[model samples]
Target: MSYAVTARAALFTLATALTLSPPAQAAVSADCTESSITLPPGALYPNGIARAADGTLYVGLITSGNVLRKRPGKAWETFFPGADTVFASNALRLDERRGLLWGNSPDFLSGGKARANRIYALNVADGTLNRSLALPAGEMGNDIVLGADGTVYVTETRGGGILRLRPGETAFSTLYRDPQLAAPSGLGAAGIVLLDDRLMAVANFGTGKLYTLSYNDPKPQLTEMQLPRLIENPDGMGLAPDGALIVLENGILSGQGRILRIPSPKAAGMHQLEVLREGMESPVNLTITPQGCAFVSESRIRHRLLPGHETEVPDSFRLYQLPLPLTAAQ
Candidate 1:
């Protein structure tokens, strides 16, 4: 090859690297001072976040939006492209054992008006949409999590409670249903970590409480715990490495959303937990890295949907990285 060809090739390689490198890693990871959620083509209120085994972050851009995936130390990538193919309620979970992601099909936004509001699965390796699961009565399925045994548990908020779907079973059965659960939006299950075995937790945005239930044996009991403060719209949930639960509260009434931490996830019968950060704007989605860095996705849509008058969110998409001290808290 000539010198000119080699020079052009070198320049092309450098450009590629720059595009893939994280904004902070460009010079320093700590240099990430500007926090923003870069919305994809159709992501207005993008929700649902899951981290793969390889540290890649997969987010649900619900309301017929694309599923956005961001590999660690890199910019976001649009692996799947289909409007509302991934539904509402930010239901996205990386099935660690099965190596697939389960997302909800809840319809809350205007874009998701015609959606079926079901559950779908995708292979992490190829981003191919595989294994679609429909909801029962399809009462707008929302958040979901997988048990250690590969059993898929989802929160059917509009349907009133949690639904459990075992492996190879297409249908589901009601695990817990109560009027106390106003809106069971986000869910996380502790299989091996909790002594109660299938320790499932759900976030109720309407009530601002984190309700936990245990499947010790034949019967399951439901318990509700209020939030530290009046956090509006507690949307997505992510479990930190140190076993603490990280909640992304969308402050709709207060016009703010914040990342809150609840220590002692296994400990039950608690009134409320604590909030680590405050004054966030519509933080709808959250994902925890292996290193315990909490990445929150903020969408200022709530501020726009005001009474009589309305405007689109003009803020750039943001993802804040918070170094949570979960281990030290423990």
Candidate 2:
């Protein structure tokens, strides 16, 4: 089943029966001795996460569309306050070379009630809003990845296409669109990355398939990436220095997320999947540091609300760090 369909069923089956309680104050871990960065429970609904070169952590909250950051050995602080216009922040991409951090706000939290569904960029140094461009009608901005030439490529989960913004351009133009790209319920595309100047890859959350598009093609054409097996509910994606792909499986209603490391699509068809971690609680997005360590956000969304009931979430949300030297299936 597609996320869009599952979401509708959940809202219909649970919205009326569940009476949400006041969110608990965020709980931070007393110990930083571990690899993971613990979130305050009150920072509920974290989806988009990114890291700066200096190790500062940035996270976007879906509940309030607020952005938060934490420096090394410091506590999490609100970087961008709640906004009525921005509904939910999904995937965040940090452009270290340009000193900008881009955020995807598809209005998922508002159920599309937000006045503007757009992609916004912030000054990484001070968290000031730099640019906000509204997406075309029927599109929900989901993931963003920067090209080598500074072009921004974004996925439209519902709109069933990709939009592009060239360097120094204020407005985004449609790069590609195909109804077949949309999920069964019409909202499908998720994670995306430009492997290099020529190849681009995307994950279909609705069908659990990875696809590739060539920039050199006169017309954008997408072909299913050959994987050893299906990756159920793939969301966030990242590229390793060695050219391997890191994929996050934001597990279906179960919240049992996992991560995968795979070679480039050009390497081979149906290559074996290397599982980096498993049994996570609704892991959303991830980013890697130059030193090779990766950070992942655990949203635990299902714990807060089931199809027929609502329960209190943990006192704090959590971001776990997986040390380098991640092993793959031999």
Candidate 3:
């Protein structure tokens, strides 16, 4: 089925029974260990994360559309506030060379406002809007990744395609689209990571499948990766320095979220996935630092999506940092 059909079903579901009430406010859990950074009270649902070279972290909230930032030894502060244009922020990518942070602002929960989905670029030094590029009508922007040559790539969850915006280009063009990228029910492409200028890894949220796209030539080749077993709800992903694939399985309704590490994802044949962490609330996205540490954002969206769980939304959110099991040769 096409994304349009699935999106209509999702919107209808959200409109009727899944409309959630305001979450109850509370304090951060005392069990939040030192490895985790607690978000401010009522941070809502955080979905995306980006880390800078200086250890500054940026997190994007899905429901509130606010972006929070934290320095190496400071508290989390609001970097960008929700606005009429940016109603929902999804995935985030940092373009360090350009000194910009790129994010998706989809109108997923805007109640059929027909607003164009946006790919926003913000100044990394300060949370100032650098540009807001509108996507095609009916396209839902989901994930973002920057190429080595300053090209920006985004996934269209509702359009079931990859969109590209080259440097100095004002409008985006469709890079690749296939039926495998679309879901019959829920979201389609949810996470994306560029392995290099020629290749990218994409995860399907609805199908829980992984695919690698090679854009070296005019015709991009999409290949389904063979995995050892079935995965669930792959949301955000990153490429480890050691060539491993780090992914988050955000259990939107089932509450079975986890983080997985797949060694040598580019290798041929079946790849074995190792569970690095499990029993997370609703992990959404992650950003890997050069020092082999990964910070994961737990959106906890199940509280809003599941019936009778509205009050279960935590008062504060969190970003947990985990050390990647890299080789000792470094």
Candidate 4:
């Protein structure tokens, strides 16, 4: 169905139930990690997930119109929503210092001349609503990333481009506006150590293509990575400390959803491996910690640990997690 329809259902169905729960607490494995915590009853189907410098998980729900956070050993908290000063939170990003959490407003949820999608900067320490950045209205804010120097890059859905916002600037300029990013969806910046050079990759939600920028050349060159046909709608992306690239299939057309792992995007005989997990209904974003923790968020569920796939997630939607590989890059 269309985004609006799904959102309406999400808002109405929210708070009616917990939706999903872990199979157990001590389980460990890519397919069996139990959930440490489940999202609130009203949280919408979550999409993009970003971790704060403090290490809390920030998940954006496209329908429920809020960004939910889960602290280590604590229950999930819904911080910002469309009802507040700004708008509904969609895509997510973090400051270079990991101090702030930013979520995109993706206009698909709210129709208006209102500032398209906005990123609400959240304080990880207190779960307080901080500042917000606004983009031109009607442009769907997809995924976002911060450069080493702290420049912020956000992708636009139908705008078919990426916008660059400096550390303290409000107005954003398109970094790359070609059709290749026709549906510029998910985005993540790789540390120089991860890809030999600081790079940023954006997934095309519509084209099933991968776009990469080598470095900060005035004009960023784009490269494409081929994927297995099974992963047609590439949504979000994550990188482990060792540089392994983890991709999430963001669409829910065929069945529910799927998560795929590619050893490395550096191209060294690496093949796509499908990660078997349940409750993936529609996996949006993923974050791999240096400690071997793979945190994933479904369109609706809160953040959970890897091997969290076995948790009892609703067939309609859910999230999963697994232990990241120690030698993920080599």
Candidate 5:
């Protein structure tokens, strides 16, 4: 099947499952203690999560384009109401310095009628739409990472490349493109994190491969990183406090979602991949706090992706918090 056909099929299946399913309240996992927060009622498929410095959280929903916000001890509020223009919010990153919250809002979840993808910048203070950039037709904006020099980089899941929006630029330009970045399963780059000014780590959701992009030179270099073992659908990624790579494996199809910590990803052969936690329910994205806790958004996509498992759809999704000890740096 062609990439477009396969993608449409997968999306159609998910939509059918969701239509057949009825939401029910489910118990939290034993590992999810007081730190985990339940998503607001009626929120489904929480795909992206970003944390503010003041103990506030911003979450983007996949089915609805709504961006929800939660303060330290306050009820959840709709930061950005969902609209037809902003269809699905996949990944989010908070640019606190610039007072913007960047997110990828694709139309894939809008009944599989894929249209132009969108990357939006919202005012962090009041959740007003600051700017919205439309990607070319047939491109799916999946994940986002902001550069130190005010550049915005987004992963094209269907286009199998990276798109860049430089400072003072009105439109995005192709930063890098390669056929190998995509998998036969139709999904391509899903997660990305800036290592420094020039380096970025990206995860391939369909192939479960990891790669590093060096964009210092005129021609950017994309090098696949050899891993200790095959990762099961790597989804979202972030940098730890001590500069280690922290990855979330969605494992929605395999039913083995987990989080991993790679102490030295550049030197993969020398360092072992530590499994921090396992058995999560389709964790799609994560954001690390300054105090060393990782907050993961459990998307629970399996309930909507698997036909027979639709009844398992939970009434409320959750955000899990796992403390990463400083000793993990070693």
Candidate 6:
């Protein structure tokens, strides 16, 4: 399911039950000034964000279908040819080794009007389209990640599975699918990241739990991750230098977001939960830079769409550089 649909449903259910109020200002990271570069004017609903090894930042617009780029200390500019193949850019991941920027375009809001869900690869050097592959009709391509061996994996938000495109392939095939990943109403299997070459950590937005899968086996083993506290709507994730998992959580039905740093998979089910930041509006994506800094997109799109919560967001959205205590693992 899409965040737009999820917010509308929650609005209908909780509009009468929960009191809606203006969002409290979140704390900016003290380590670094909460300094941020604004997206290009009209680049509404910024969703997915990724940073290249060269300190360039790329942001995807969910509504306008535009991808914006900014270099350190520079203003944001429209990337590439501008929404030629991108319909609804949701998640972006950079394959630095190959100089490619991968994005998932799912028509959650513009369904029927927009094109089908697609996985697009663009050359970061010149912002030229490299490859575009359409998924099966009706599949929602929500998030993307690259494997250590150059394999590409994408999350099917509604299909409850992962789609894979090997290094030299132009088409994607179902890598894994199971009922456990299916959501009752909203999204299931929202975010995914490779813990290593063999193991993958996935977030189930519908159920609010994490699962670990070993992709090396023909039929991989999938197990629920036992965390000290469950992450509600875990959308995007990254790894820390010490192997901890950093998760971006959209609050449970309230659009209040948070960032969590949890113990490494070696500790697995029982590990301390570290709250890196909280009180974000609707953080959807997360990325770590080469210098070990963490950045997040405060989309706030869901909060604005929810009925009573429309007045809670600001005139514009923002991207925050978090003051994480750890660095990206070498």
lDDT of each: 0.58, 0.70, 0.75, 0.56, 0.75, 0.72
lDDT of 4: 0.56
lDDT string for model 5 (1-330, tens) is: 011223223331111211111111222334324368888789988987999988888999877789999988899999999666777766889999999999888765345557677888988877888988998877777889888777999888876888999999999999998886776667878788887777788887777678988866689899888775656678889987667788887775566788788766666453456777878887889898665678899888676566566557687889898776444343
Give all TM-scores, in the order shown. 0.76, 0.84, 0.87, 0.73, 0.87, 0.86
Q: How many backbone clashes does candidate 2 have?
A: 9
lDDT (Cα, tens digit) per residue for candidate 2, span 1-330: 112344443321112221112211222223322366767657887778898867788898766668889888898898887455555666888888998888877654335544657788888878788888888766677788887676899988876778899998988888887665577645577888788777888887766678888755788777888665566667888876556678887766556678777754557555556676779876778786654567877776755435554456566778888743332421
- Stretches of model 1 off by over 4 angstroms after superposition: 1-42, 72-75, 83-89, 111-113, 183-196, 226-230, 268-272
Tell me the TM-score of model 3.
0.87
Model 3: weakest 10-residue lDDT segment is: 12-21
lDDT of 6 by residue, 1-330 (tens): 146354534321221322122222233235445455555656777778888766788988676557889887888887854465677666888888898888887776554675677789889888888888889877877778888777899888776888899988889999899777767754778778888778888887766678888877889888888765556677888775556687887775765688777656645446555676778877888787544478888787775556676556457778888655553333
Q: Which 10-residue window in model 5 sums to the lowest lDDT?
A: 12-21
By lDDT rank, best first, the candidates go 5, 3, 6, 2, 1, 4
In angstroms, give how far residue 252 of model 3 lies from its true place. Answer: 2.9
Model 6: ten consecutive residues of lowest lDDT: 12-21
Which 10 successive residues of model 2 have the least lDDT summed? 12-21
Candidate 4 deviant stretches above 4 angstroms: 1-36, 52-55, 81-85, 96-98, 110-115, 125-129, 183-196, 228-230, 268-279, 300-318, 326-330
Which candidate comes out best when scored by lDDT?
Answer: 5
Off by over 4 Å in 2: 1-34, 111-114, 303-305, 324-330
The regions of model 6 sitting more than 4 angstroms off are 1-4, 8-35, 111-114, 308-314, 327-330
TM-score: model 6 vs. ground truth: 0.86
Report the error of model 3 at residue 291, Å: 1.7
Residue 2 lDDT (model 4): 11
